[model samples]
Target: MSNIMETSDNEILFIVKSTPGNRQREPTESDPVVSTLHNRKVYKGDTTILAAEFSAKSSVIIEWKKNDFTIYKESPQYHAGQSILIINNVQHCHHKKKYSVSVTDSKGRRVSSSSKMKVRRDSGSKISSSSSSDSDE
Candidate 1:
């Protein structure tokens, strides 16, 4: 339990009190709050990260997918702490693709969000070579 008090100078103070057999409270079967999915554009061969943020008091399951294919669902790739999906050294193959994340709580409550990834060609690369010699008539 906690109490809030106001001083004469308009300063607020909080006092926390503990009781016997008191434990932390947990969320009760409420739908998870998920962040809005935003589209991203990046240059080819660039590193980018896709994050799926959510809030829940209980244990939840998270899954990351790309074009209906599963990814980062296991260890070394799945980061449950920050709820983020990482893509290193992005390439043209990742362009114009759909990425999504789904979260589910123990009570069967679920939430999901998806966004499209757009890739652009690098400006520093040349496509063709120019010749110095010209035709004479």
Candidate 2:
């Protein structure tokens, strides 16, 4: 497969579909860019979401992992129809490690849609509290 557009850290906007052995249609920014993975490179203590999208004729597979541990694979997202993978990593947080994801076609040819799994140590946290009875007293 050919990379019609350079991968971007920003949100993707378009994808090109071509006939076999023909130049794929160059998608303008207006075309929908389907993604099978998001935040592919997440850290152990970091919690994020994974998601993707596709058309009626397109299919995808998502494989995610931490180190050598396989977290997910060839998984179907958003039921068995439109492709989407939404993964909340908060419950499965492990030792700080880089997460990986691989996306492919039904025939196993890969498409370039990778991301950085990053964790910020000092990003701070949100604390919620009501008026404590002990403190109120």
Computed on alpha carbons, the lDDT of every model, listed in order, comes to 0.49, 0.34
| Candidate 2 residue lDDT tens string, 1-137 | 32222221123221221111211343232332334333333333333443333322234554445554544554343212222223332322332344455545555455434433444344222211112121111
Which candidate should be chosen as best, given lDDT against the real structure?
Answer: 1
RMSD of 2: 15.0
Candidate 1: tens digits of C-alpha lDDT, residues 23-127:
123334587555556677655665555654555545566656678765534222221233555454456664457777776766768788887776667732321
- In model 2, what lDDT does residue 80 have? 22
* C-alpha lDDT (0 to 100) for residue 103 of candidate 2: 47
Off by over 4 Å in 1: 1-28, 74-81, 123-137
